[model samples]
Target: MRVVVLGGAGFLGSHLCGTLLAAGDEVVCIDNLSTGRRTNTTPFLGRPGFEFVHADIAAGPLCVRGAVDAVANLASPASPPDYHRMPLETLAAGSRGTEHALQLAAQHGARFLLASTSEVYGDPDVHPQPEDYWGNVNSVGPRSVYDEAKRYAEAVTMAYRRQFGDDVGIVRIFNTYGPGMRPEDGRVVTSFITQALNGDPLTIYGDGSQTRSFCYVDDLVRGLVAMLTSTETGPLNLGNPVEWTVLELARIVLEVTGSTSPLEFHPLPQDDPTRRRPDIGRARRLLGWQPEISAHEGLRRTVEWFRARPAEVAAAAPSVAGPQVEPRPGARIPSPRRSAPVLS
Candidate 1:
């Protein structure tokens, strides 16, 4: 199989590239390096089956010769901090970027899989979100840039499938944590790990009661591959059904890292969901995929990766300063401040 992974140098895409290469697929990685780092894919640069291209997905259609067997559109600002910081770019990638990938897939007669997100559920009212749920989302809220962009992305993906009868697969990935996750990505897993490593207080938002389901990266990658190969084209929910409270996750991070960090809390951000757990019944039936990695083991593995890459972790983590405020036990941690001013 000849596979093209857009945003290939990104945390998840990098791992996907390695996974495909290991599976005997010829891989072409396309990334702009805006958020992805070349270092992530450096190891595979010289592999006989691996090729890398540095280009923005929004710069028009990707230029790949010959037929492509598979196209995995994994490019987008995944984290809240990132999406909020680059709203237009995020939207463009989700819309235009997705279109480009689909066009490539159509042109080459390849199967297309999109790395969608649970954010599409939009502060879901349903306890365990199912694929059929229409979702409850605020289009004008702070998080709309990401959620709506993904919503549109999914819509366009479906349009391609319905109108063109294209082989399109959409996986609404839940919170996945693992070794390849960017340390400063500001997701809960990385934030908690970096904070614990630095002996800083673990921050939470909104009484610490909000819940989320985490899927291990390896398990997610497996699910992705399964979806790509399967005849089932889904807006399938792919994630571990095991749910954990924000406080529970923080405690696990502290225990795993052996950090004596205190708990800090703040108000939850706008549009932050109270609970998010994927109802993976469809995934189970269609792909026989269920998350096998527990939070404890996942966190341990993530911490080990962070510890192994001290320089990367240090560069990505937030700067430490200021005494802990009145501890808000379960509040959402603030989004990392944008390094460069975002031009509206």
Candidate 2:
């Protein structure tokens, strides 16, 4: 099979590309590098049956040669810090990027997959959010750039499926972290891991009571592949069901890294979800899939990854010389994990 993956150099997208390639599929990876790092594709640069294209899916039509059996639209500024910095670009990705990917799939009679997010269920009123839940998003909020973009993407995906009978699927991904995550991406896992390694305070927003469910990258990628090959047209939820509070997760990070970094408190960002967990019944029922990696095991592996790259983690760490100043909206830390061996 020939697969086209947008945002292919990103943390999750890079893993997807590697998985598809290992499964004996020809892969064409596309990324704009606005948020994605080129080094993420370094391992596959000279490998057979893999190609990387530097282009923005939202800018205009994508130019490609030959046939495509599947198109996975994973493009966009996915992290909170990223989307917050590139608001217009994020909006464009969900709108124009999604449209172009759908068109490409439709033209080639290929299966289409939209990599939506759990953010669509923003600050949910429903516990363990199911796909059927209408989200409680504030369209004008600071996080709306990503939340609403995904919501729009899902809407357009369903529209194409209903109106044109497009072979389309939408997977709402939750918090997934592993080797490829950038240390300074401002995600809870990455922040905790990097800070603990650097012997810095683990910054906990609010009283750290907010909750989230994290899936290992490998497990999440397997679920993605299952959705790509399945016949279900769904807004399926794909995430580990194990739930943990922000404080609990921080403590776990401390344990995993064996760091004595003290915990520091800060105000929670506006519109940040106080609770999040996925009811992945649809994915389990339709695709016969559930996460196999336990949180403790996953965190152990992740800490090992960061520990092996001490310089990268230190370089990515925010300056803490004197007064505490918030990082600029979109500032990014270089991720060297791209050069690391592919996770099995």
Candidate 3:
């Protein structure tokens, strides 16, 4: 099979590329390196089955010459810091970038897989969000840039399927973490792990009550492959259903890394989701997939990876980016930015 992975130079995209290559698939990886690091794809540069293209579909035309079997659209600013910094690019990736990939798949009569996010279920009113939830999101908020982009992406993907008979699938990915995640990505896992390894104070926001479900990258990539090969046109929730509070995650990180970094509390960001957990029953029934890695074990492996990269980990000083909040007149609403965004 031949696969075209947009944003293939990113943390999750790079991992996806490796997994597909290992399965003996031909891959044409495309990325502009805006937020994706070229180093992530360095190991695959010389591999015969892998080809990397330095291009951004959102910026201009995407010309891939050959038979395209599957298009996996993972080409957005996935992290909070990344999307926050590149708001326009994020929107473009979700909208124009997604359309380009869909168009490419349409052109070749190939399968299209859209990697949507749990953010579409923004600060969700529903707990353990199911695939049907429409989500409670502020379209004008700061986080809306990323949230609306994904919502739009999903909508466009479905439109393509209905109007043009494009074979496409959508997956709302939950918090995924593992090796190859840039330490400075600003998501909670990487931030906590990086801070713990550096012995810096671990920052907690919004009193650390927010909850998120973390999925291992390997588990996610496996589900992606399953969806790509199968004929299911679904917006399945592909993530670990086991949930953990931000504070609980922070404590676990400290214990795993054996760091005594004190926890620092701060104000919560606006439009932060109070809870996030996916109900991936559809994925299990449809694709025979479920996350196998426990957070502790995944973190252990991730911390070990970070440990090997002392320079990178040390350079990623944790910073809680948001406004301050004084205790609500003795109510003491001590919180910081949500246990880190639940983005990939």
Candidate 4:
């Protein structure tokens, strides 16, 4: 099988590509090199079955050398820092880019898997969000660019599947973290880990009571593959059921990193959610999938990855356009002016 992984060079996308290749499938990864670094995909450059294309999926279908068997559309900016920084591009990627992937999948008669997010749930009135919930989202909020874009992407995907009889699947990913995660990435785990490692004050926004469930990247990838192969075509939720408050997560990070840094509390940014966790009943019943990595184990792996990366790469990894602050862990980059609450 030849698989096209949009955003294949990104932190999660790169790992997904590696997994597919290891499973004896030919992989063609397409990335815009905006958020994804070429060095990230260097590992697969010379492989007989791997190919990389430097193009944004929103721009159009890929010009690969061969036919594709499946399309994993993981092309959008997932992190708060990335989406807030590249809002327009993020919106385009989720909406137009997703549609583009569906078209390509339809044209090639391939299975399509859309990597949706739990942000679709917004600041929910319900605890442990289930797939049946329609979600309470602020469409005009600053984070609307990414949130609404994904909602629209899911809408378009279902339209393609129902209207055109396309074979498509939607996986609503949750707060996932693991080895390939960029150290400076704005996700809480990375932020806390980096700060603790650097002996800097860990910033805790909004009194640190907001809760989120963290899923390890490997487990998330496995679930994605399972969904791809399963017969259920749905907007299925994929995340760990374990839940922890922001302050609790901070304490865990301090313990994991053995840091002496104090915790600093700050005002929560606009559209920040109060709580989020996944209900995996559907995933369990349909795909026999549940997250296997605990938050402790996953954070340990992520911290190790951050500790191993070259200083130059770590400094340059987040975004060149970001603030000029030192690239240390826990270094507080400015939040987006009109930020929406991110899934993580």
Candidate 5:
């Protein structure tokens, strides 16, 4: 199958591209690189059956030359720090970008998949949020820019599906982390891993009791592909159901990196969810998907990836001026290592 993946140069997007190519599917990857790194997609450059296009779906229409059998709209500033920094861009990507991708899919009669987020459930009243639960989001809050935009995107997708009979599916992705994640992306996993590796203190907010469910990138990508190819038209929840507190996750990071970094406490950001977990019953029943990577193993692999390229990770670390540090001239380039699957 020929597939078009927007935001294909991002952490999760790059993984999706690799997985699809490995399955012998033709892939057209498009990204604007606002938050995505070109280096993430470097492995696919000039590879057979893979094409990369530098374009922002929010800016204009995505014009591909050949037939597109599927369209996966993964284009958005996903991380809290990223969306917070680029609020307008995040909103546009969810609104305009989604509209553009939906239109393209409709034109080609292709299957459309929207990579929505668990943030839409925002500080939920319901624990282990199911797809049917209406979220308790604050529309005027600082995080609303991302949360509301995704809610809007889901609404628009449903509208298109109902009005034009488009073959569209929506997946609410939870916290996903793995090797391709930028060291300074500001997500909890990357932050903890990088800090542990650098021997810096792991920063925890709100007494470190908030909880989250993390799915390994590869497992999430498999779920994505399954949803794309399935007949279920759903706003399916996709994530590991195993839950861990912030303090527990921090401990795991330290253990994985074998670091003695002290834990530092801070005030929680506004509108931050105290607990987040997904009820992925639909995905399990319909797509037969469940994450296989345990947190310990996933963090071990992530630490190894960072340790192998310390200079690159440090250079990308966030600061007041931005990611501007220069890497050492002769730092060794580490060969890519595949993440090991968890054994039963």
Candidate 6:
């Protein structure tokens, strides 16, 4: 199949491009280096059936030649620090950027896939978040730039399907980590990894009780590919169902990297979900997909990748240790920091 991957130079998008190419599929990778790394697609530069376009879909209309079979829209600043740094761009990516992808797919009569996120379920009241759960997002909050963007993307996706009879699929991705993640991304996994490797304090913005489910990138890409091939017009949950606390994840990162970095406690960031775990019943029933890699194995591979990049990891150290938000006596742990879509 011929595929157009928007933001194909990002951590998850790059992996998606690599997977599609490995399956003998033709891939046209589009990206603006705003937050995506060119190095992610460097290996695929001369690869057969792989073409890279350096452009932002939000900035202008996309141009692709020949027959396009599918358009996988993964464009955006996905990490917390990135979206926070470029709020307007993040919002544009979700709103304008998603429309461009949908328009491209509609033009070609191809399947459109929207990569939504669990962040749409802001501080979810539901225990195990299901597709049917309408999210509790803060439209005016710091993370709204990303959360509302994705929510808007999902809304626009459904509109395209209903109004234009476009073929599309939506997948609500959870916290996925593995190789290709930028160390300075400010994600819980990346931050902990970099801080541990550099022997810096692993900052826990909260008291470390907040929970998140981490899916391995390989497993996530598999689910994405499955959704792309299937006819399911779903906001299917794509992530590991296993839950882990912030403290648990921090300990594991330290253990995995064999670092003695001390844990520093601070106020939990406002809008940071107290808990997150996707209910993938629909995904398993519809796409026959479920994560297979354990968190440990995924972390081991990720640690090795970061370990090889000593300079990047070292440089990421200072950013990981940011200004702390201290909780006063008997005060709630709510902080003023912003979350991008979903923050840990």
Point to the candidate with the largest TM-score.
Answer: 3
**How well is each residue in 1-344 modelled by candidate 1, as lDDT tens digits?**
99989988988899899999998998888887878889989889899989888777765766688668999999998887777657678888898788888888898888999999999999999879999998999998878878888899899999999999999999999998888777777888888888888877777877889999888899898898899888788899999999999999998888999999998887787778999999999999989988887888888888988899878766765623222333445645434322311111
Which should have the higher TM-score, number 2 or number 5?
2
Which has the higher TM-score value, candidate number 3 or candidate number 4?
3
Which is the leading candidate under lDDT? 6
lDDT of 3: 0.87
Per-residue alpha-carbon lDDT of candidate 5 for residues 8-98, written as tens digits (9 for 90 to 100): 9999899999999999998988888988999988898898988888777877665676688999999999988787677777888899889
Q: Candidate 1's error at 73, in angstroms?
A: 0.2
Q: Model 3, which residues run further than 4 Å from truth?
A: 323-344
**Model 4 steric clash pairs:** 143-340, 194-329, 195-329, 195-330
RMSD of each: 6.9, 5.9, 7.9, 7.1, 8.8, 7.2
Total backbone collisions for each predicted model = 9, 0, 8, 4, 0, 0
User: Which run of 10 residues does model 5 get worst, by summed lDDT?
Assistant: 335-344
Sort by lDDT, best first.
6, 2, 3, 5, 1, 4
Cα misplacement distance, residue 323 of candidate 6 (Å):
11
Clashing pairs in 1: 204-331, 204-332, 205-330, 205-331, 205-332, 206-330, 206-331, 208-330, 265-328
Off by over 4 Å in 5: 316-344
Alpha carbon lDDT at 339, candidate 1? 30
5 versus 6: better TM-score goes to: 6
Per-candidate Cα lDDT values, in order, are 0.84, 0.88, 0.87, 0.82, 0.86, 0.88
The TM-score values for the models, in the order shown, are 0.91, 0.92, 0.93, 0.90, 0.92, 0.92
Candidate 1 global CA lDDT score: 0.84
Per-residue accuracy of model 6 over 240-321 as CA lDDT, tens digit each = 9999999999999999999999999877666778999999999999999999999999999999999999999988844543
lDDT of 5 at 207: 91
